[model samples]
Target: MLKPVAAIAALAMIAACGGSGADESTPPEVTAAPAATPAPVAASTPAPAPVAVAPGEPSPEFASLPAPYNAANYAIGKRTFKLCQSCHLTAEGAGNLVGPNLHGLFGREVGSLPGFAYSDALTNADFIWEPHHLDEWLTNPRAYLPGNRMSFAGVRKPADRDALIAYLMLETGYTSAEGDAPNE
Candidate 1:
């Protein structure tokens, strides 16, 4: 009776250790706890920086327009603006679509859309949408305004852009076909 009691006591002691010590040859069942944390080492390097603006105010991509309005150039601007009309409205206070109202937009301050949210791309983009600035944007809107939501491929031809910009200036009352200020 004493020997049996001793064997039972030894078995209880082995179980208390949390490791099964039934026999020297018997394998113990140990459940590993799940690793709840990730390693501290960074798996990948950060992404490259963005290239958007010039060093100073809109690095003179387009020199301010020369004195005389080039009829020929304005014609080109008119045609170029047709492409812009697809995304932008040409009427004053028109409804917003992909972009804001462009009527009287030439001299308007940037990011003043009544209800539309402009991309940071447009607000920070130096230079008003003047004839010269529009020319560059129509040339390549994506490059001109990186991260701009408008997905225009941009007009490639200078003559075409000039015609379109001329029209925009005239329509927006920013300049005349002769490059004079619009008649008040």
Candidate 2:
């Protein structure tokens, strides 16, 4: 009885692996072992260097703002960023959490912040942290880099990504001097 069950199981495994088509004369093919499954984008990876800010850094409260800075989309983005809060910190002096602090995130090199030990994939990334790149990354992090270690499934909606980036630009290490207008 056990022998019959084992035979059935083996047959099922072969069928699942697509083994039914070959002829008796054909030689068996060898394939490489599969690589590890990529982690989700929302998950945190390691960063090496020690940060200046403490884990729970305090920031000053701001009064009401004017115009584009206070746009509705920006508000939406702030809400969207809540999804990222578990891994990253937005306060000016906040230290690293599961991921790095996002205080002055834009215009900086990817994975270049000192004190955080970054995975080789991120540390070797050549691009700077611009809006477009951020969009691609947020769309699907595992697709972006198959083996880097972020684990949260990415945000699929374009609108959500847009709002989140807008918020990050405004709230994370933004200076009043760098107004919303593009630099000539």
Please give the distance, in angstroms, between residue 5's alpha carbon in candidate 2 and its true position after superposition. 97
For model 2, the stretches where C-alpha displacement exceeds 4 angstroms are 1-72, 175-184
Clashes of each: 12, 13
lDDT of 1 by residue, 1-184 (tens): 8999999998899788865745657666799999889769888999644323422222121234432233335434544567677778877667877888778766566667678898898777655445556666677878977888878888876556554655565455464333233222
lDDT tens readout by residue for model 2, 39-135: 7686677754322332222111222322222332544565689999999998887899888888888777898988888888898788777666677
lDDT of each: 0.60, 0.68
Model 1 per-residue lDDT at 172? 56
Give Cα distance to truth, residue 176, candidate 2, Å: 11
